[model samples]
Target: MKESHKDIWLKRKQLGRSRYLVLFGLLPWGLGLTVITSLIELISFQQINPVWVPARLVLFFFIGFFVANARWQAMENRFESDSQQRP
Candidate 1:
């Protein structure tokens, strides 16, 4: 059976929300892992570069932002398509 525009839109919206939630939830875990890795390096080597943490954080932030933006764009496209299909 073919799905209606409304149904497609709802599904897309749900997917977009889930992607955003996943991104938000994983961000902290990523940061934690970075910190743990940094600590391990520091402990093992007795000298760790201090610039890695900020660079890692900035990279994480930009990646997350890009993912979130992509999901948002998908949701927006679905919304527009749904609206166009309406009478």
Candidate 2:
């Protein structure tokens, strides 16, 4: 028998032991943007170029946190809907 969506979500939540998945997703995306900008600066050889590493870090944190919260919310919603649907 096929597993319910709720069961799948529960397993995904419980098995998501490491909190690093959020970082893994956020860092590559943010860092990719940062690196591209930084490279453009290097290629142009601009004096006193500003890449804003701090701002990139903030973006990374925000994205990571948002992703984590979204995952949790999705899981909770799935569980609640499943419970409501059950007889």
Candidate 3:
């Protein structure tokens, strides 16, 4: 089916919102993970291990996926509500 202009615009808006969420949200989350992981390693292992770098990358990827998904859902919900309100 051919898509309307409004639909195209909405999709672009949603994409932009998701990108914004993923890019901005990942920084603080990764930083917090690094700090907590470092603290744990320091207390338990008495030194920060090199393994943390890879582990952090994997964890950050998964967490970023979920966070972006959540933000997309929220944007979708808001878009639906706003569309419904339009005459």
Candidates' C-alpha lDDT = 0.66, 0.63, 0.69
> Cα miss at 28, model 1 (Å)?
5.6
- Give the alpha carbon lDDT tens digit for every residue of 8-83 in model 3: 6476676586566656456656656767777888999798888777788668767866776676677578767777
User: What would the per-residue lDDT of candidate 1 be over residues 1-87, giving only the tens digit for each residue?
Assistant: 136755765765676665664555347545755677789988998977988888766676666666666756776786777678877
List clashing residue pairs in candidate 1: none
Q: What is the per-residue lDDT of model 2 for residues 10-74, given as tens digits with 9 covering 90 to 100?
A: 66667563544454445665676567666776778764255576686668667766776676776
Query: Which scores better on TM-score, 2 or 3?
Result: 3
Poorest stretch of ten by lDDT in candidate 1: 21-30
Candidate 3: residue 10 lDDT (0-100): 70
TM-score of each: 0.47, 0.51, 0.58
CA deviation > 4 Å runs, candidate 2? 1-8, 15-51
In TM-score terms, which candidate is top? 3
Model 3 global lDDT (CA atoms, 0 to 1): 0.69
Rank the models by lDDT, top first.
3, 1, 2
> What are the root-mean-square deviations of the candidates from the true structure over C-alphas?
6.1, 4.6, 7.5
Model 1 whole-model lDDT (C-alpha atoms): 0.66
